[model samples]
Each structure stands twice: as C-alpha cells, then as structure tokens.
Target: MANLRDPVIGPVIRAEGLTKVYRSGPVEVQALRGVDFTAAAGEFVVILGPSGSGKSTFLNILGGLDTASAGRVWFRGLDLTALDDRGLTRYRRDHVGFVFQFYNLVPSLTALENVALVTEIARNPMPPAEALALVGLSARRDHFPAQLSGGEQQRVAIARAIAKRPELLFCDEPTGALDSATGIKVLEALTEVNRATGATTLVITHNAAIREIADRSLRFADGRIAEEVVNPVRKAPTEVSW
Candidate 1:
C-alpha cells in the first residue's frame, strides 16, 4: 500500500469518476454523476445537499456501507473498489468510525458498556471511560439510553464509535433529529473529537449553516457537486445556527 503522508500524495482519501445507479425492473435512477473528491488527513469536510442530491450515496460508498455502480476509491492509496466483501468489512472495522442520525445504543447497556462493546473486539482501543470523557459524557457513563437525553445518547454513540481510535470518521445527518441548541452541542462534541483525535472527518447534512464549521464544504445538486467552498477560518460550533 502507498502512504498517504507522502507529500506527493497527501490525500488520505480520493475518488475518481464516481457514479451510482439504482435499478428496479427496467427503471434506473442515477444517484451520482461522475463525482471526484479528495480529503487530506485530519481535515473536516461537510457535504450539503437537499434530498435526492446523492450526498448520502457518496458517503455510503466511501465509508464502505455501499458500493459504487462505477468508480474507484482510494484510502491511503489502497484501492477500495477492488476490495472483496471481507476486505471491505475489515477496512470498515479497522479504519472507520460512523455516527448516524439515530443513536443505536443498546437499551439495556449503560453508556460505558455500550462503548465497551466496540473496544472488546477492537485490535487496540482506548478505555471506554476515556471515550465518554472525550465526548463530555464522563459523568453519564453509568446511565442507560432511556435515562439520557437524545443528545446525551448520541454522544454515547459517538464515544462508542471513537473508542477504537479509527483513522476516519463519517457522520450522516448527526444533528437532524435535535433542536438547534442540542445540535450545536453535538457539533461541538464532533469538532472536539476531530481536533483531539486528528481523524479525517466527513459530515453530510441538509443544514446549510452547518457548513460554516468545516474546513471545506461541498454543495450537491442533481447528483453532482455544484459548488465547493474553502473556509479561511471555520466558525466555532457555537457560532453556527440553522
């Protein structure tokens, strides 16, 4: 495998001529259209798009949850498109952490235990307590999902995802279900974790305001990236409003 840290090829992830098409009984929906993307290590990139714009499809393909109908993806110069099922699974398990819209915590498990579920199987992991602390939930380690607020539960989910110290983090609509204030808190936690862990972070959301907090933002429309913006200085999560 080639090294991403080499100055000549500094991107941690790269995609070329990406496309996705969903088919059913002679009907085909093109979800992505020849997309090209790259992200450097430790960079925070936000993708913004309305429904059906293909942002989610792009993320899922890159994160190994779904395969592209056509394209090639590279992670640290490893060709992801060529990976078999087991190789993809191992790649996801070892290198990626994911946060989705819902907190999928086990109802009966405490925050710490829920986090421990991942650490137990990881090759190397931080203590569950430390992961909770990273998300500002150290005091709630003993609380079950039902006992915590939605934001708190989501934080616990984040703690679980990061406990294994993955190199990349992918978040899809992470704040979609929260109110503005709670969403801000979640964004703050995400930013904190990104800074602390130096994970290459990618967030996909419909909220345009959230773009203000990222190093770069891409706007998707009609299955293509319509605009790209680089933030000279990212706004603090607290400063973002939607």
Candidate 2:
C-alpha cells in the first residue's frame, strides 16, 4: 500500500486488468472482464449501460465496496487491491463517498441530522448545515425524511455523502426512482456538488440524458467498456432532458 501522503503523478484513480466473479455452488458469473480504467482529479464521469453490463461492479471495485478477483486498483497512488478488509474500510471512510438510488436517510432523523451523522465521524467534515445548503436543502433542514419530497430526500443523501469532503464520490442510479422533473432536480444538486467540491466523481446510471452533464461519458456492454466520449462542452442539468 502506498502512503496516503504520496503524490500521484497521473490519474487520481487507475485500474488495470480488473475482473470480478460471483459463484453459487454450480453457478458462476463474471461481472467485470479485464477492464482498464482511469479518472483524473476532479473529473465528472458518467457511466451508462443496460443492467448487468459491469458499470456498478467497476464502480464498486474502485470505491472499495468490493474487491476485484484479478488485477489491481490504485487511488492517489495507494494500492487498493492489496488492502485487507480493515484497510478497505478505512479507505472508504476517509477517501470515498457514495450515493445510491434509494434515499437511505433515517426516517426518524431530520434532513440536517441525517447529514450530520456522517460529519460526526469524518476526519475533515464541513458543517452539516453547509452541506445541506450545497444541495439547496437548507430551507428544509428541519424536515424529516418522511416530510421531504423524493428529490429533496435524495439531495439530503447527497449532502450526507459529500459532508465528509471525500476525495471521490460515486453515485449509482441516483435518479432512478424519481420522476423526470424530480430527477432533474437531483441531477442539478449532484452537478453542483461536483463543481463545488472538485471530487473525482463517477455517476452510473441507465439514463443517457444524464451524460450531457458529464465531462466524459462511458458506455458499457457485455462486461466491457464499449465506447468513450469526451463532451467538449458539458450542459447544465436544466438543459438536459430525461
């Protein structure tokens, strides 16, 4: 494992020959197939694919939520594939943040409190209120998850993920559960957070329209990256359609 302070000369994240397999008795499934990938510092990347094309698997491996069966992954020059479970946990806690499709906020906690939960344990967290404000949720900070709209709840979840000031942010199907109008709102929040924090952000989604907001777009097929596009000019979330 490389030291945390070691300067990374190239990509903030790099992966080579990454692979993953899941087994169940006589059944075997390959989720990722020798994928090579990289992301520069503060890059906002969007990944698109049909279900089971390996997008989520790739994101999980890079974010330390899952390990690759073969090959290596590096973040800021630190070898992720070499870390044990405990080390991976620390890596996630200290350097990575994640938002999933579901707004997994505590039903009993207010939006502010839910965001505060992450800040309480973070090494260098921003104020919880400020995190909420980033997502345009400060006005509803006192509202419980049950009281907020779907988009608002998801924004709160984004606030929670970013509160820790992570070096990387991974969002998987973050707008999947919302309607078009609401999903656009959530996307706006995500784009704003990416711009404000400058975190190396990866958003995996089935919606291709979301790609317009990304600096780079990747398409996956049959457990491989099928195409890559560099959007010369990224459009604002409001300019995108579902």
Candidate 3:
C-alpha cells in the first residue's frame, strides 16, 4: 500500500542536477555534483556520508541556507534556486525549521523563553508549552540552558524548531554531541514531530545505524549520492542501535 501522505501532499521536496562550486581566490571546489533527489510529505529521510562528502552542502542548498550553482531545487514547487535572498528568507521563516549539532540556546533564557521567542515571530505557531510537551520537556521548560543536560538542551532546540509548526525540517547531525541513549531520545523527539506535523524531514548524520529509523536513506560519496535505500518497514527510534 502506498503511504497515505504521498497522495495528500505529493512531493514537498525535489532536487535535480544540483551542483555547488565554491571558489576561494584561485581554488574551485565542487561540493555537490549533479545530485537528484525527492521526498514526499511526511517522509523521514536520512543522509549518511563522511566529512566533505557533500552532505552538508546539499542540505544547506535544500534548506535554503545556500544556493546551488547549477540545476534547480524546489520545496513544494517554489523554485529555491530562483529565489533571491529576500524570497529565501521569507520561505525559511514561513515554512522551514532547522536543528544543528550544537544547541545554540541563549544562556539567560529558559527553555520556555527560548521557544517562545520563535513563536512570537512565527505566522502560525503552537504555544511554547505545547511544543515543550511534544519533546517531553514540559518540566524542563522553565530551566535555563545551563541547568539542562546535553540531551535536554537539544530537546529544547527541537521544541524551538517545531514551535512554529514548520512544513519542512532539516537536522544536521542533531545527535552528534550526545551519548547513544541521549541521542536516541533526541531522535525520538524528531520522529515524534515529523509524525505529528507531517513535515518532510531530512537528517544528515555520519552514524550508519541511524538509517534504520528512516523511511528512505541516501548514502553520499565524493560529492554525489552513491546509493539509496528504502526501508520496507521503518524501525522506531528506540529500536535503533548506535
């Protein structure tokens, strides 16, 4: 049976023949080389690659943080490569959420405050308390970043990311700073949000074991996607090892 989400939202993300060439003085480095990819709504995708394998480059372009040098990419038919900086900013603010390896929370702000800051500016946002509850951090919502553990801080980051109810999410090594158990908890929050919000989520990480939880996985090599793996049955984050 086809995933019900496939027909509902169609392909929320699409990339074709993407290339990124960065020039520094006389040096020209091709980060991504002719990559083509797509993700349906509510799909959980994982990307695995070593450092400098174009994983981050591709993700940055897909997330609207950077532009592609050639080809085109789209989020729900909005041509990202065609958007100017102002248009891209609007697109990001209205539709995209991001989580990085480091939780860049303000030291003086409590978790609730950190999340509330985003909700204040978002066009349509859930209450900060509800977002905290979604990440199992309702109790810690009042705690400052210094008071929270690494995993807890990351959960707060997740809460902040999803508080706006973004249609798309990009996580770049979200679990890179935590222990295995803590990482699993972070992944749990991510999966929960992806399920509840029907966001097309793309997680970029080096941990191969993490792929088990993805509906689709891409392995990038030397500035290109070398392999694609589709999971017949996705494993719950709790069941993933390493």
Candidate 4:
C-alpha cells in the first residue's frame, strides 16, 4: 500500500501553459487556453467539467493522443514536446494506460486473451490470470465479451489497462455506460487498484458524485481550471454517493 501520509516528492506530470486550437472552417476554436496543471506520483486527481469545457482535450494531450498547439507537457521530467511520433508511441505504451467510456475489447477474444494481447508486448507484465483476478474477474476469465454483463466487460477493460502496470492510469468517463449500481462497482475496482499498486490515476467526469473518491478535484470552465480542491479525507468508492 502507498503511504497516504507521505509528502509528494515530485510531479509525475506537468503541463505548462498548454494550449490547443482547432480550425473549423474559417473559425478558430480554442480547446485549451494556457492550462497549467501538475499531478504528483500516486495521486488520484479528478477533473470535473461539462461538455465543451475542454477537459477531454486536456486529457488527450496529457495521454499523448493529441499535440498541444503551444506550451509543453512533461512526464517524469521528460518534455513530451521533445518526443517525435515514435518516441510518443513508446512513451504511451510504456508509461500510460487509458480507459474510455466504451470497452474496446475485441469481440472475438475472451477476456483473458484481450488482456494478454497487450501484456505480450509489455516489458514486465502481470499474467492474464493475475490481471483478471485483480479486477475480480477471475471466474469470467474465459468468457467472451458477449457473455459478460456491461460491468463485467468494463472490469475486463480495466484489467487489460493495468496488466502492464502502467505508471499512470487515465480514465475518461469510465462509468458513463453503466447503471448506478454497476458504476459503483467499477469505481470500487479503480480505487482498489490505486490503493494496492500506487498508480497515479486521473479521471475526467461530469458526474460530481464520483469526485469524492479522488484525493484532489479540479473544476474546469471555458478551457481553464475554475477551482481546485484537495480532499483531506478521500472516501472509498463504496462509501460514495451514486
């Protein structure tokens, strides 16, 4: 378990004056307006915002899926802007894990196979069975996506993301597709992973109820952080309101 009382030694991720602009027709839209943020190692950070607030854009830039129009991103002191396409690909593969709203599992593959597909390429990875067990899906390891419930499939996706033991886990609306009860379970699984492995976790969500589980929460408006709050006592997912 990570020492909750330990001081944040250094930032694992830092965004300095980050900006992203999009050209739609003759109009220019700014998705991120010089956003500055930093996340410490093993910290659980939640970004809250409504649609079009640029939270997703910020996440994409941090995850290496999108490039910033201006400014820079640093991960463990490596300037992301300095990395070329190949370097960015390697950085993502080695240092980051992503969980989106949809479970992008291969329809033809069983849960175990889906996870192993990624672990096979990882430098040092947990076994498929171990990964499945971590997400409480050991019994359903052989089950195909079609055979699992919505929540079960999402758990498999979570297992797949964490099998590589990524230094950072990025989740964007991970519970958006589930019911209230199932969302709670998925959140519980995420909290368990953070507690057990000390992975730096970031979640982007519109659901305010889910914010209580994070160590820090930031509210965004019009492409910038409007407010940031640190929770003195982070609640377990099971204790959070739906």
What is the overall TM-score of model 3 with all chains considered together?
0.96
Q: lDDT tens string, model 1, 1-242?
A: 55433443478889999999999999999999999999988899999999999999999999999999998999886899999999999889888999999999999999999999999888779999999999999899999999999999989989998999888899999999999989998999999999999889999998999999999999999899999999999999999867
Cα-based lDDT for every prediction: 0.92, 0.93, 0.92, 0.90
Clashing pairs in 4: none
Error of model 1, residue 121, in angstroms: 1.6
How close is every model to the real structure, measured as TM-score?
A: 0.96, 0.97, 0.96, 0.95
Ranked by lDDT from best down, the candidates are 2, 1, 3, 4
Give per-residue lDDT, candidate 4, residue 192: 86
Better of 1 and 4 by TM-score: 1
- Candidate 1 stretches with Cα past 4 Å from truth are 2-9
RMSD (CA, Å), each prediction: 1.7, 1.4, 3.5, 3.7
Residue 197 miss distance in model 3 (angstroms): 1.1
Which candidate would rank higher by TM-score, 2 or 4?
Answer: 2
Residues 1-242, model 2: lDDT tens digits: 46563555689899999999999999989999899999988899999999999999999999999999999999876899999999999999999999999988999999999999999899989999999999998899999988999999999999999999988999999999999999999989988999999888999999998999999999999889999999999999899977
- Estimate, for each residue in 73-156, the C-alpha lDDT of model 3 and write its tens digit: 977757889899998998888888999999999999999999999998898899999999999998888899999999999999
Superior by TM-score: candidate 2 or candidate 3: 2
Stretch of 10 with least lDDT, candidate 2: 1-10
Task: Show the lowest summed lDDT stretch of 10 residues, model 1.
Answer: 1-10
